[model samples]
Every structure is written in structure tokens, then in C-alpha cells.
Target chain A: MIEFIPSAFAATFSVSVLLALAAGTFAGIIIGALPGLGTVLGLVMALPFTYVMDPATAIALLLSIYVSSIYGGSISAILINVPGTPQSAASVFDGYPMAQRGDGALALGYATVGSFIGGIFSLIVLVLIAPQLAKFALQFGPIETFALIVFALTTIAWVSSGEMLKGLLSATIGLFLALIGPDAMTGQIRFNFDSLFLSAGLTVIPLLIGFFAVSEILYQAAVLKDVKLPAVTSGGFKLAPWSEWKPRIMVILRSCGIGSFIGVLPGTGATAAVFVSYADAKRRSPNPEDFGKGEPSGLLASEASNNAVSGGAMVPMMALGIPGDGGTVVLMGALTIHNVIPGVRLFSQQPDLVTLIFVLLFLSNILMLFIGGFGANLFSRMLRIPTTLLMPLVFMMSVVGAYAIRSNPVDLFVVVIFGVVGFLLRLNRFPPAPIIIGFVLGAPLEMSLRQGLILTDMNFLAFFASPIALILFCITGLIILNLFGLGNAISKRFRRKETQSNN
Target chain B: MQQKNADMLYGAVLAGMACAMFAHTFSPIYQNEFLFGDVSTVFFPRVLLGIIFVLSMMLVVKGKLSTSDAILTQINVKRVLLTGGATLITVVGVWYLGYLVMMPVGVFLIGLALGYPNLVILGITSLISPLVVWVILAKFAQVSFAPGTLL
Candidate 1:
């Protein structure tokens, strides 16, 4: 696989791939800087173009957009207090303050450098860990796989929505949606209401466009009160002296580690990582009072950790075929369109493609650093583009994207239907990501469970006999116990009993 | 509406839907041939529907006992309906009128519905953006677009 690096580089340096990298980076930055069009929507809009692209070029484009879009969010965060993406929500704490004080260029410098380091750190983690994880996954039989999917879904649901019950309900709904098409093992169509279109099953792309893009448009329409653009802070790029950055080196490294670790976990995404890293950075800072007042360390921790998540989130998606967040879900969907199925088999079967992905991610980060620095002012200017104007364009792209895939007019309706469904669900405080995760993992979960059951000759309890499956199920049980507050209650009772005994 | 009331209502609706779906799983369309002994085609879906039913019931219980005073966000129902209606019309328009002919109109209509202030800019962008996109996607990328039957 190491030998494939040279070939990967040769492939990446091709005119077509390089063009894709540049265009993806440029478009991603603008999309990110503009509030309301974040990484998922950026990828959704880019999906139609990928229909004609070769796999390599398509992956290059998506990878660049994914990496750069995360970085692009800081532009809006710094220039205006509005975060362009949810992942960058923490960036505004210190970034906007710095810009308010006319150090916007220096702030941009810190964010760009921190994002680069974080990206590189995560890429290294990805390169080292993904293959090893994939190798470990090869040992999993159907029982273990079922256990793993259940655990992953549980963890995802627990963290996605604030309310555990709502999250679980959302996930269950998603699972039901996946079951609507047909049963894979028995060739029996279960929930299709006798329509011809119902038998073929739903495709991920249209579902994605509906849930992430069209639903967003409807949500925005419902909530948007002000069409006026926020005032932009001055933006430029100026690298801070080494003396200024030297003290923050530890903060950057700590944030990179935090982001990478959190990113590797299923369902917890960069948003979680950034806030956690920010709090940790503040806790350890000597000048904690200055933390939110244009503190470079705070900015560094927020920016670095969020960007680092770009690499960390891919680990589960690439290694286990489990998406960590909406961005990766869209990425996974795109990869499937190109017939590049991600999972335990992907590492062994297509080492070359994996190597190319690594190279592409590495190049994307590098491109982000250069492009982010040079294009800071331009991105700040783009913040003036109102959501009112941008959303119509998104809607158009949604229509085109849905129709372009398989050329089915029914898919257009799928986009509209899911769009409304997604919007309604969101209005009711149901988190959308778990639904997608549930949908994606639904088929595999059913297959693995049935297969495991067959292997055990209908002895359901035999699933627990596998040590790996047992451990996974135990963890899931603990999570469920915690969700119900039983874990905490039991621990508190035990502690009280211990105190009484000591007395 | 209060958050609790909304949740209870949503849960009841979902529970009802789940019950309907669960019953439908036993319909003859499923072909209930059990090649794997106990596992039939409807087996997994039944399990899922059952989970949904239980979860929704729990949601209703939780909502009934909830003490929080949080209210649901004030939604502009008229705007949501208008925007959704505009989107559906756009899709239907594209179906009959073709991508090249109806897309610009769709974009313009959506923009107007979303309350874009600058009509001139909206008109220009709505007209030109789709044309540019079509040119690039259709001509350069060799992707096909629906030509309107009416056109």
C-alpha cells in the first residue's frame, strides 16, 4: 500500500484531478463562508456534477469540498458573529472579538495555520488507524457485526438529539423508512403500497437531497426574518510572529488530539469536538479571563479541532461504513454512486483507491491553507450574499440533482416529499442525522441479525456467546442504562451504601 | 403550542401509523415464504415497526409527564406552505415543461416565495444561473436535461 503513494500522487497531479481540487476548494470556501450553505449542502449541490466524473475525480472534488468547507466557516464566524456552519459555532467566541478589534487578518492567520495542523494531524491518524481498524473488522462475523451496528446506532441516537427518546424515535423512523422498499434476503416486498416505484426501493441521493438541502430551504423560509446582510469585518491575512504562536503550540496539539479522538467516535462530530476543545483550552489557560476576548489560543483550539474532525470523521465511514455526521453520510452516498463501497473489504480490495483518498485529503488541507489565507477578504465579501438569494439556487440544484440521478421523475417527488417530511420532523425537534444513520445501517443490521440467528440455529441467546458481540452489547446496555438514568441512580445508591458502611 | 403537547400529538400520530404498518406486514404481498425457518421477508420490518410502536408510546408517556415550559418555536405556517407549494409546482413544471424551460421559472418562483428583496437581481440570477448550470452540466459534462414536452 505504501508503494501506491507514488501512483496516487501521479493520479492526483493529473490536470483533471487538480482542476477538481481547486474548483472544489474555491466553491467550498464560498459555500462555507455563506451562512446557511454548509458542508452537507455543499456536497449535496456538488453531487449532480459527479454523475459524469470518473471515480477518482469525483472523490477528489468531494474530499476537497469537505475539508475546505469546514475551514471556510471561520471566515463568516470571524467577519460576522454568525457561524457559517454548525461545526464552527465555537469559533465566533474569540474570532469575532478579534475581528472587532481590527486584528481580523491575524485571526485569519491563526485559524488557517491551526486548521492546517489539525487537518494534517487527523490525516496521519486516518492513515495509521483506518487500515488497522478495517483489519480488526475482518474478524467480525454476522453476530459481531450486528452488535457493532446496534452499538453504533445507539450511540448516534443518544448524542444526536438533546432528548434521548426523540433521538431513538427518529432513528426508529429512519429504520422503518429503509424497510419500506423490500426485504433483501427473501425478495419479499413488505411496505411498498403496490406502486411500481415502491418496489425498487429508495435511493440515498434523493433522500439526502431531500433531508439536508430541500428541508433546509423550507426551514429557512419559515424562520428567516431579516433579509439584510450583517456588516462584515475587515479581512486580510497576516501570519503572526513565531513568538505569538509559540505559547499556543500546546493548545493546538491538545485540540488536534481532542478533535481527532472525538471525530473517530460515531455520531459525535466536529461541533462536539470544537466546544470540548475550547473548554479544555480555557480550563488550562493561565489567562482564562481573556479566553473569549480575542484570545488566539481559544481561536486556535476551536479552528484546529473542528478541522481535525474532517479526518477523524472519515475513519468510521471509511473503515466501518458508518458515517459520523451528515457530511460523511453525503460523502458515503457519493462514494456508493461511484461503486466504491466503503467497509472492511474496501481496505483490502482497493488499496489503491484508499491511498488515493489519503493523498487527496492531504492535498485538500494544503489547498485549504493556501486558499483560505489568500481568499479571506473575498470570502468575507461573500458574506454579504443573502440567504434569500442563495436558497433559490439551492432549490434549483436540488431539482437538477434529484432528476439527474437515474433520470427518474419520481425521484423529483421523493426529494419534495422527504423535504417536507424532514422539515416537519425538524420542526418537532427531531434530529435528522440519526434518521439517516439508521436508514444507512438498517439493511446491514437486519441482514447481520438474521444471519447470526441462522448461524446459531434459532438460539437468539447464542449471539452473546461471541466475546466480541458480548462486549459490544454490554457497552450498548450501559449506554441505554445511562439514557434511562439508571446507571447514575445505581452508582449513587452504591456510593451512599459505601458511606453508611464506613460510618 | 407547548412542546409537551406537540410531542404527545406527534407520538400518537406515529403510534397509529406504526400500528397500521405493522398490520400491513402480514398482507399477502409479502409472500411470507420462510426460507430461513423463522425468518420471513416481513420479519425485519415487523421488528422495526414494533420498535417504533414501543418508542412512540414511551414518547407519549414522557410528554404527558413533562414539566418543562418550553414552547415550540413560532413557525410562519403561511410561508412554509407557500414555499412548499412553490417547490411542488416547480417539480411538476419541470416534469411537463422540461429542465431548460421550467428551471428558470422554478428558481424565480422559489426566490420570490422566499422573499428575496431585489427583484432585478433575483430575475437575473434566476434566469442566468440555470442557463449557465445547464450549459456546463449538459454541454460540458454531457449530462442530459429534460426537454419540456410543451416546448
Candidate 2:
């Protein structure tokens, strides 16, 4: 992998790849700055273009968008009092306050600089941790793999939605959707309703387009009121003086660490990281009372932590073939289209490509820093584009994206159907990310389970024989128990007994 | 509607679908014949449907036991339905009339349905954006757009 760095650089510096990096970064900033469109939708819209690009260019494009979009969210958070993406939700606590105080440029500066540092910090963590994680995963047999997938899916569901039951239901629905096409083991189709198109199974791209993009369109239509656009605070590049930043350096670094750590945990994403980091920053600050009231540290903590999650989230996706969030799930889907299967073997089989991904990510963060700074005003202006006007373009893009993948007309229907279903499910408060995660992981989960069962002579008990699998199963059981509040009950009982014994 | 009722309704509907899917797993379409202890193709799907059914029931029970006074988001039903209808028509239109033809109409109709107040902007964007996209994707990237049979 170390030796492959030179080639990775050579590959990345190509005209096409560089162009993709610049374009993707620019488009990502605009998309992220917009209120409705976020990282997942940005990736979905970029998917069709990737179909025509080579593997290197495609990876560059997607990686740039993924990194920059997370950073882009802070622009809106600063100017419009609305976080462009959920990951930036915490930014509004301080970002908007700063803008209201006529310090929008300085707030954007903190966000941009903090995001850059966070990104680079996470990239370092990714480079160090991913290959090692991949190496450890390579030792996992079918049973361990099965256990890991279950744990990942369970954790994702638990964290993704407010209602754990709804999240679980959404995940189950996604798993079922994955089973609709041909069975991987037997090549026999199931639940396709005898349609010629049903046998082939649902493609991730169309499903993604439907669920994220199209569903968003519908969801917007349902909720969007005919109102004037909110006034946007002025935005420009203004670096906070060194004196202003000196005291807040620790906060930025700590938030980045928190974000990177949380990102490494499957299913816990930037949204969780930002809030946690913000709380930590406030708690640790000497002037905690100043926090969240136009405090630069709070804005930095939110922006940095969320941006750091970008690199952190990719670790699981690139190493273990597990997506940590919706953005990574979409990124995983894009990688698959280019025949770049991300898993344990990815490290050994294509170290060069892995190196290339790392390099692309690094470059994307750098580009995000420059592009975000120079283009702040442009993105701020973009926030004025009404959802009414933009969503229609998004719909058109969704149409093109769905149809362009394999040029199958049936995919158009899949996008529409999933879009409506996604919108309806969202209205009912079911988290869409878990569904996409479950769908992406579904086939592999089933395959690993069946293989493990076969290896164990069809004895389900034997699945726990492996120490790794046993630990994973135990952790999963604990998570499920916690979800049901049984873990708390049991803990309370133990505490009561301990108190009695102490008395 | 109350959040509880919405949950209950959604849960019941999902449970019904799960049950139907579970029954389909037992259909003759699934070759029940086991080969060297390999499970049938229906095995995994059955397991999934079973999980779905259980979860759906849990949702219904949770809904029943709920005390929260939360209400579901108020949807603009007419706008949603009209937008959905427009989307369907646009997709179907693309299939019949081709990308170049239906895409602009689709974009325009979707914009109209979404209540974009500025008709001129909507019309220009609907017409020009598709052509720009077509030129880039079809000409530069070599993507093959849908050429309608009618055209």
C-alpha cells in the first residue's frame, strides 16, 4: 500500500480525475448549501455521470462530493439558520447566531477551516485504521461475517430513527426488498410476481434515486409552503485572526477526535458526532456560558466533527463493506458499479485502488477547503434558489439517473415506486438510511448465514462456536436488549441488590 | 391523524404484506427439494418475512401502548397527489415519448405541480436544463438517451 502511493498520485493527477475532483467539489458545495438536497442526494445525482466515467474518475467524483457535501452544510447553517444537512444540525446553534450578529464571514471561515482540519485528521485516521481493520476482517469466516452484518444492521436501525421499532421495521422491509429478485444461492427468483424485470432484482442506484432523491421531491412537495425565501446573511471568506483561534484549537482537535471515533462505529454518523462534540466542547470550555450564543468554538465543534465523520464513515465502507450511513451506502453503491467491490479482499486484491481512494479523499478535503473559501458567496446565493425550482431539476436528474443505469426502462418505475414508498415511510417517521443499509447488506448477510449454517452442518447453535461470532452475537443481543429497555431494568435490579448488600 | 393511529395503520399494513410474502414463500415456485442439506431458495426470504411480521406486530403494540400526544406531519394532500401523479405521467411519458420530449414536459409539469410561482423561470428551466443535460450526457459522455418509439 505504501508503494502504491506514487501510482495513486499519478493516477489522481490525471486531467479527467482532477477535473472530476474540482467539479464534484464545486457541485457538492452548492448541493450541500441548498436546504433540501444533501450528501446522499448529491451522490445519487452524481451516480449517472459516474456510469460514463472510468473507475478512477468516478471514485474521485464521488469521494469529493461525499467529503465536500458534509462541509457544505455549514454554509447554510451560517447564513440561513438552517443546516443544509442533518450532520450540520448542531451548527445552527451558534452558526446562525454569529451570522445574525453580522459575523457571517467569520463564522464561515471557522466552519471552513475547522472542516478542513477535521477532514485531514479523519483521513489520517482512515489511512492508519482501514487497512488494519481490513486485515482483521480477512480472518472472519462466514459465521463471524454473518454476526458482524447483523450487529451492524441492528446498530444502524437503533441509532437511525427515534422509534426503534419503526427503524427495525424499515430495515426488515429493506431486507425483504432485497429478497425480491433471484436468490443468490439457487438463482431461483422469489416474490417477483412473474414480471420479467423482477427476476433481475433491484439495482442499488435506482433504489437510491427513488428513496433519497425522488422521495425527497415528494416529501418537499408535501411540506413546502408557498412562502418567501428566508433572508440570507452576507457570506464571504474571512479568516479569524490567530489571536481569536488560539484558545479554540483544542476544541477543534477534540471535536475532530470525537467525530472520527464515532464515525468508526458502524451506524453512528456525523449527526450524533456533532451534538456530542458540541456538548463536550461546551462542557470543557472555561467560558461555557458563552457557548451556543454566537460562540466560534460551538460552530467549529459542529462543523469540524461533522466533517471529520466523512473520513471516519468511509473506513467501515472501504474496509468491511459496511456502510456507516446513507452517504456511505450511496458511495458503496457507486463503487460497486465500477466493479470496485469494497471488502477485506479489497486491500490485498487492489492495494493500488485503495491507495487511490485515500489520495482522492485527501485531495477532496484540500479542494473543499479552497473551493469552500472562494465560493462561499456563490453557495450563499444558491440558498435563495427555491425548492420549487430546484426539486424539478432533481426529478429530471433522478429520471436520467434511473434510466441511464443499464438503459433499462423498468428502472424508471423502480425509482418512482420506491420514491413514493420512501416518502410514505418517511412521513410515518421510518428512517430511510436503515432501509438502504439493510438492502445493501441483505444479500451478503443471507449468503454468509447460509454458508455458516452449511459449515456447521445446519446446526444453528454452532454459529456461536467461533469466539469472534460469539462476541459479536453477544454485543448484538445487548443492543437489542437495550432497545427494549431490558438492559436498564436488569442494571437497576443489580444496583438495588448492591445497595441492599452495602446497607 | 394521531401518531399512534398512523403507526397502528402502517404496522397493520406492513404485517399484512409480510404475511402475504410469507405465504408466497411456501408456494410451489420455491423448489422445496433440498440438495445435500442446502436450504431452499425460500428459506432466507421466509426468515426475513417472519422478522418483518414480528416487528410490525411490535409497532402495533407500541402504538397501542403509546401515551404521547404527537401528531403526524400535516401533509398537503392535494399537492402531494398532484406531484405524484405528475411524476408518474412524466415517467410514463418518457417511456412513450422519449427523454428529449417527455423530460422537459416532466420537469415543467413537476415544477407546476410543486407550485413554482414564476412560470417563465419554470418554463425556461424545464426546457433548457434537459437540453443542457442531454448535450453533456449524450454527446460528451456518450450516454444513450431514451428515443421514444413515437418520435
Candidate 3:
């Protein structure tokens, strides 16, 4: 693979980075304020505009949007129980209660502070660690790439967030979707059935709009309840003072660390990051029960880690060309489209662009302070938008967005069909995330596996015998055991028998 | 809301999927002389599906479904159908009336269906929804969206 890295850091300054940051964050906030709108949709929808811009400027704008959207979701979750994005699921635990308790302003402030701290920490590491990882990743051949994807896929089953069956089922559905296109080995189409749309399987934009956007619109509207924001939250806004916040240092650092780890792991997404971070913060805190009851520390841990995860996910993607999270997959795709082939060699080849990316990453995280702190409360009123009007808009937007992907009627149709399928799956309590991941990763994985086999003469023994694959297989096996309640059973036995003594 | 313990449909669907997948595997493996690539590609995912199929069937047979974390017990079919139907209409309608007419019209109608009935609010909702998206998506981050039938 040819790697294209621009010359040394174009002698860029904080000014350009700041401008890009301001522009992107502002845009992200606006988009995020609209229910069912999100970072992925924001970034992907913005791709065409980048066609004419400098690579740095383009990357900066997109990265800023990525950073701010994580914070944007917090605005809604805190003011309204509805989480705008799945990652912000954690924010609702304490954020909503805080708002209800008349601490909406204070809760928003903490969320902003927590987001900034997390973003800044992850940015520093992204600059330092990404290049190192990239250099190492350049050494990988198709074998490693194939193995990496397999590992990512297997990880999803584990990340079913304590529900492996649901995860596997969703993943199976995804793989099935991926198989709809032509077979990689024989170049034969599987399920086209006289339609041109099936020839390309399904595009990401429409499906994303359908599952995440359209479905979300319907779901949110159905649950719509009219609740007023703090009649006036501005007067109540408080930072809680950093000196007083020092007790949360452990929570902040630990959550950031864990959040970054979660972000770097694919399929673990923000929702998982939020729950685990919240639980960990509570588990480690001096007062664990205070969580989910409007504790600022709970918000701190949840917000920081979740935001940090936004940046941290890029670490794996830039280094190994592996998508660290769903957002990074979009990022990696954006990079490739700009013809910036990922996987290591770019760090040495284009120090300038790399530096630009670093600066942009930093700028985006910092910009969140401005976006989340001042803009958040003002935007929080989106919760007040009646679902009746909101639902139709989301549906239309999904259709338009899906059709926009290829401008093909076929894609639009697929989006609608998937909308119904997605709705059906959701009704049945089937998680849609895994299936999306599956379809997204399936084709590439199948192609890679076949290519590897073709290279290795169809050796079935090759996959397991490889040390990395062996490790991945073993980990997947352990995850299965954990999901089967073996881990829970073991841990449960060790706990004191409070139930027996209660009587 | 308690999770509906009904697994009959879920189990049946999975079983059908498994049969199709297994049939695909069998056709290619036995009928074709050249099944290159590792057999695991064939065996692995299928075995995985077989396992899934069995698990789903067991769940269905036992009727042991659980909805542990869901806040809403049972989904309203009327709500789903109305929403889904309205979206389908808007999507299909756009190809004919164009994005502008269809979106506003769709938003207005669906809004009414969902019980939002201020024409002023509905009109503003339709206009601003796409417009706001336009500014953020096109002007800021720079991606193209559907030009639809309308500008």
C-alpha cells in the first residue's frame, strides 16, 4: 500500500487550529441539539464539502464535530431523560435527576468540565501514541489485517454489554447482510434477485440514518413527555470550584483511563463506556450508593471517560488501520477517501499532516469547553420539542440522507426496508448495534479471509496456529464463559450472604 | 414493563435463517469441486449460526424470554405502524413531489398523526429541520446530502 504523508507540520499555528475548532464545534453543537442527529451523521454528511479543502482543514472540521457531539449528547440527557446519542446513555443516570432536583445548571457545568478534562487527556495521548502504533502497524500484512478484523468482530460478542446472545445474534444478522452482495471468491452474487440495489448490498449512510436516526425518532417520540427545563437555569449555573472538585481526581483519572481503553476497543462504543465507567467510579468511590442519585462525581466519571473515549478510539484506528469504534470507522473511511492511507507508514511520510491532525485533535477537545459550558444549557431545551413534529422530520431526514449516499433510489428503498427491519428487531428487544457492525465488517472480513486462504493454500490450521489468533480465540472463549454467568456465579459465591442473615 | 416472554417468532426466524445458511453451505461444499479457502469460513460461521439457531429454539421452546432493562413493557403496534407507514409514504412521496413539498407535507401529516397540530409549528418544524441540518452538514463539516426533488 502506498502511504501519502504531507511534508513537515506546515508551520501551522494555534490560530488556524482554533478557527477550525470553533467552526466545527459550533456546527456539532447545532446538529447535536437536534434530536436523532449525531456525530457520525454530522461527519459523514460533511464529507463532500471536504473535497475542495486542504486535508488539515478538512480533518480539523470533522474532528471537532466528533469531539463536540459527545458533549452535545450530555446536554439533552441532563435536561431531558432522552439521550441524544447512544454514548450519552451514562449521562442520563445522574444528569436527569440533577436537572429534576434543580441542579441542572450545576450538572451541565460538571459535564462540561469533565468533558474537557477527558478530551484534553486523550488528545495528548493521541499525538504521542498514534505515531508509535502506526509505525508498528505498517509491518502487518494481510494476515495481521485479517486477524485484526476477526479480533474486532469477536470482541463485539463480548461487548454485547453482558448480553452475549443478543450480541452474537445481531452480529450474525450483520454478517448475513454483508453476504447479500457478490461472493468474493467466485464473484457470484448471492441475493441480488434482479435488483441493482442489492448489487451494492447497503450503504452505511442510509442504514445508519435508518437504524440510528429514523428508529430513534420513532422511539423518542413514542416516549415523549412534556417536562419543563429549569424555568431559568442560568442563575443556577455553578462550576462547583476546582479546588472543591479535587476529591474527584481519582474518579476523573480512572474514568479517563478506562474510557480511553474502552474507546480503543472496537464495538465497545460509548454506551458501554458510560455504564462501565459509572459502575467503576461508584465501585471505587468512598460512597458508591451516591451514584445515579445526582452525584457530581458520578457525572464527572461518566462524562470524562465517555468524552475521552471519543479521542481514544482513534488511537487504534490511526495506528493499526483498525476502526477503534464506530466513529473511527467513519474517520478511517474519511481518511482513505482523502487518499490518506492509514497503517503506520504515514507518520514518517507526512509529519506535517500528522502534526496538523494532532493540533486539530487538541483544538477539538479544547473547543468542547466553549461548546459544552456556554452552549449546552441553551441547547438543552431541545427536550421540549414535541415528538409529534420531531418524528416526521427524523423520518424524512433519514430518507433524504440515505438517498444522498449514492443518489440511488435503491439505497432509499433499502433504508426504508431496514427501517422496518430495525423497528421489528427493536420491538423484539434485539440490539441493532451488533447487526450494523456485522454487516459493516462482514464483507471485508470474508474478503480478507479468502485472500489469506488463497495466499496460504486453503490451510484451515493457519488461523488457530497463529499466536495472535490463538489468543483472540481464547479471549472470545473466556467472554462466552463470562456471558454464560460463570463469572457471575463465581463472584456471587464470594459475596457475604446478606439474604440468609436478613431473616 | 416486563419483557414479553414470547420467543416463538424469534426462534422460528432464526431457525429459517440457519436452514438457509446451512443449505448454502451444503450446496457449495458438496456440489462444487473447487471449494478453495479454509473450510472454517464455511464451517465456522455456519457452526456459529447453528449454535445460535439451537439457542434461539431453546429459548422459544422454554418461553423464557426476559426484558430486563427495557422501560417500556410492550411496544404499541399502532404507534409503530403509523410511524413506519408515514416514513414510507414520505420516502416514496419524495421521488414524486420533490424533497421540499414532500418533507414539509410529510412532517405536517406525520406530526398530525402523532398529535402535533399547530400548522405554524409544523411548517416551521419541516423547514428548520432540513435547513438546520443543511448549515451544519454542508457549510461546516462539508458533506453533500440528497438534493431530493426540491432544492
Candidate 4:
């Protein structure tokens, strides 16, 4: 890892890193301020623009947005009960309560600081760990890479909202949906008909936007037309003093460290990290009673860890070609479209650009302090923005973002279909992220595993032979047990109370 | 829907998916190519189909909807429209307007849907977001995209 200073590289950003970060941070905040507009959706929306820019700038912008959006989400969660992004779900545990008690300013202040701390920690991790991971990744082959992907996918069930069966079912749905286009192995196409677009397979970005963004909007519009915005005292300023923050520093760091580590795991995103950290903090605290009753530490822990996930997710993506989440999936796709290949070689091949990106992520997270600092106040003001003016604009951006992915109307239709599927599933308690997991992994999982299977002469059960595979299997098994009612006893044994609200 | 009916519907979806697999499996195109003593590429999907079929059956009998109706009620229509509209926008935007214009437009629309109205805020959001995308995707990453006719 290079002991690089982001400030030293600011002058070099004329190559587009500065512009990317500026633009990315701006969009990230807006997306985060709005409830349910996720970073994946935001990045997918931005995919088209990358076609015209430099890869470093493109990555910087994307990374910056990814980082800032994670933090921006707390604005809504803290000021209003609704989490702007799912990762901020834990933020509401205390964030909203604080607001309810007319401490909205205090909550935002603590959350902003916590998020800044978390983001910085994760970026530092990216600097320290990413290169090491890249070094280790060089030792991997198709077998190791495949094992890693499997491990990531298995985490879906573990990190899923509730019910491993549903999570597994959700993963199954994603895997199948992925099969709808081409046969990756042969030159032949499998699911496509005469439609010209079918030969290329469904674009993942449009699918993500539809399922996560458009579908979410449709569901919200259909039901929450008159969402009750919580009472607010215009929370745009910092309410907590330095002294109040001093005590929570350790808690924030611990949360960020935990969050960053989990974020690197893929599937286990910031939301899960936040909830887990909050629970851990609460359990370890002498003042456990302070938690869930508008305690600053709980919110601090939640924000710190979730923000940290931004950096953590990048480790695997940079080291291996495996993108850790939907956001990185889009980033990889965008880069591929730009001809920027990832893997162990990317660092050595494009050290300047890659290093530039590392520094940009660092700068973006640190800059987030300023962006998030003032952004918190401005976002709090957004609660008063009339939806009459609000929703149409959101619809507009999603529509535009969808179009950029492939410039295909068919993709738009897919988005709508996925949106409907997402809505129905949400009603049925089906999480949309799994659909993405399915789509993202769909072709790769089938094609790769099939190749591995064929190479092993249909041993079929070769999946279980490897040590890594066994560990992944265990994780999947644990997730299944946890996601289902099967692990309730074990979980109860592990903890005294189940006060950790499921996000 | 009642638990019984929901379970039935889920089972049907799984069953249909399984049938789709069987069609692919038994078809001459696949079965005729019996590579490696009748074990070939179709095995993976076939295995998947079998697993899905089993899972579906389990749902038909032992499966529970898990979520209470009250929770379902909260997921409502606006969320659906928002997600649907965003998808429609992204898919259609790329097809019609240039990618340059479409990126900002998508951001604005998503921002709008989530309840941000001030044109200035929306404009800043729309413009800035695309530029970032353009720089990363176009400039740094070295990938190409669908630039609209206007550009």
C-alpha cells in the first residue's frame, strides 16, 4: 500500500478526478437525501456519462458518489424516520427518535461526524488493504475466483432481511432471471428470440434501476402518497459540541472497522453492518438503556459502519474482478464499456490511474466532511419540499438513467417489469436486492460453474471438495438457519434480547 | 391473498419454471449431444431446476408466507410507481435522448420521484451527476457509451 496523501494529488486531478468527485459527491447527496434512492441506482443512472470521460475521472466520480451517498442517506433517516437508503435503516432507530424529541440538529450533527469518521476509516482501509488483496488475488485462478463469488452469493441469505427461505427464493429468482439471454459458453444464444436486443442479454444496470429505483417509487406512490413527514425543528446546523463527540470516538471507530470488514464481504452491506454494530455497541455498553432511546452512540455506530462499507466493498472488486455489490457491478460494467479491465493486473497495468482512483476515494470521503457537514442542514430542509414538486423530478432522473445503460427501449420495458416484480415481492416480503444478485450473477454463475463442472467431468459435487467452498457452504448454511426460524434458538442463546430491529 | 392461495401461486411459478427447464432438457437439441457419457452442459441448469422444483413443492406444503398482511400493506403503490417509472426512464432515456442528456435527466427524475422539487436543486443534481459519470466512464475508465443525437 502506498502512503499517499490525497491532498498532494489534488493538483493531478486535472485528469478528471476532481471533476468526478465534485459531480459524484453532489449527485450522491441528492440521491441519499431522497428516501429509497440507492447508490446502485444512482451509479447505474450515471453509467451513460462514463462513455464520454476518462476512466480515472469516471471511477473517481463513481467512487465519490458511492461514498457520499452512503453518508447522505443519514440525512433523511435522522431527520425523518424513513431511511434514504436501506443502509441508514439503523439510523432511524435513534435518528428519528432524536428528531421526535426536537434533537434533530443534534442527531444530524452526530451522524454527520460519525459518517465522516466511518468514510475516512474505510478509505484508509482501501489504501492499506486493497493492494495487499491485489497481491493475494494474483495467486487465484478460476477456481479460487469462483469460490469467492459463491461465498459472496451465500452471504445473501445471511444478510437478507428475514427468512432465509425467502432469501434463498430471492436468490433463485435472480439466478433464473439471469438466464434469459445468451448461452455464455457456446457461441449460441439460449433465451433470445428474434428480437435483436436478446442476443446481447439483458443489461444489468437497467434491471437494477427498475427493481431498486423505479419499482420502489411505484410502490411508494401507490401507497405513501401522503407520507407523514416527522415534525422537524429545521435541523441544518451542528447541535453537538466536541465534548459530546469525544466519548463516542471509540464506538464510531469500532463500528467503522466492523462495517468496513463486512462491506468487503459482498452481499453483507452497510445496512447489516450498521444493525450489527449498533447491537454490539448496545450489548457492550454499561449504559445499554441509552440505546434505542435516542442515544448518540447507537446512531454513531450505525452511521460509522455503514459508511465504511463503501470502501470495504471495493477491496474485492479491485483485487479480483468480482464486484462486491450492485454499485460496483455497475462500476465494473461502466469500466468495461470504457475498456478499463479490473483484476490483479489492473494495479500494475494502470498504476497511475488506479492510484489516482485510490486518492480520489480518499479525497471524496474527507471532502464528504464538508459536503456532508453543510449537506446535512440542506437535506433537513428537504423534508419540507412538497412532493408535488418532488416525485415528478425523481421519475425524470430514473427514466433518463435507464436510457443510458444500453440506449434500448426493450431495456426500459425490462425495468418496468422488474419494477412490478419488485413491488409485488415487497408486498410479499421479497427483497429486491436478491433479484439483482440473481441478475448480476445469473450468467456468470451458470457459465462459470458449468465450465468448472465440465472440466471436472461432471463430478457435479466438486463444489463441496474445496476448503474455500466448504467455508462458503457453512456460511450459506448459517445464513439459511439464521434467515429462517431454524436459528432462533442459537440466536437467542447468542444474545439476551432481540431488540435489534430488523432493517 | 390467503396463505393457502399464495403458497399455491408460488408453487405454480416454480412448477412453470421447472417445466420450462424440462422443455430445454428433453428437447433433441440438448439430449442428442450426450458428451462425457451423457453428462454435459445442461446438467447445471437441470440441477437448478430440480432444486427449484423441490423448493416449490416444499412451499406448497411446508412453506409459509412469513410476512403479515399489515407489513405488505405498507409496501403500497407509490413505491411501485417510483421504481417502475425510474426503470422506464433509464431504459427509454438511453434509447431516445443522447446519453449525455439522459444521465442528468435520469438523476433529475429519480430526485423528483423521491420528492425533491426546487429546480435549482434538481438542476444541480442532474448536471453534476452526469458530469461525474461522463468523467469516470468516458474520461478515466476509457469506456464508450450511447451519446444521444444532440451530442
Interface RMSD of each: 1.2, 1.0, 4.0, 5.0
List candidate 3 stretches off by more than 4 Å: A1-20, A30-58, A80-86, A89-104, A139-144, A221-242, A279-295, A324-326, A330-355, A381-383, A483-503, B1-5, B21-72, B127-151
Please list, in the order the candidates appear, how each scores on TM-score for chain B only: 0.93, 0.95, 0.69, 0.75
> What lDDT tens digits, residue by residue, belong to model 3 across residues B50-80?
7668766755653454535444335555666
Model 4, B1-151: lDDT tens digits are 5655566577778778787875776555554454444345466567667767876776666445435433225444464566456646665666667567676767666656655536696778678766765676567655455665444
| Best-performing candidate as measured by DockQ | 2
Compose the digit string of candidate 1's lDDT tens values, residues A24-97: 99999899889999999999999999999999999999999999999899989998999999989999999999
The digit string of per-residue lDDT tens for model 4 on A28-135 reads: 877776775668767766665565666667777788788888887888887767788888989988888887888887888888778888888887898788888888
lDDT of 2 by residue, B7-110 (tens): 89998999999899888777877866776678778888888889889888888888999999899999999999999999999999998899999999999999
Q: A359-427 in candidate 3: lDDT tens per residue?
A: 667667767787667666557654555546656755665665566546666666677777667766666
Report the CA-based lDDT of candidate 3 relative to the real structure: 0.68
Residue-level lDDT for B128 in candidate 1: 97
Q: Which pairs clash (backbone N, Cα, C closer than 3 Å) in model 2?
A: none
TM-score of chain A, all candidates: 0.98, 0.97, 0.82, 0.86
lDDT string, candidate 1, B88-110, tens digits:
99999988889988888888888
For candidate 3, report its TM-score.
0.82
- On lDDT, the stronger of 1 and 3 is 1
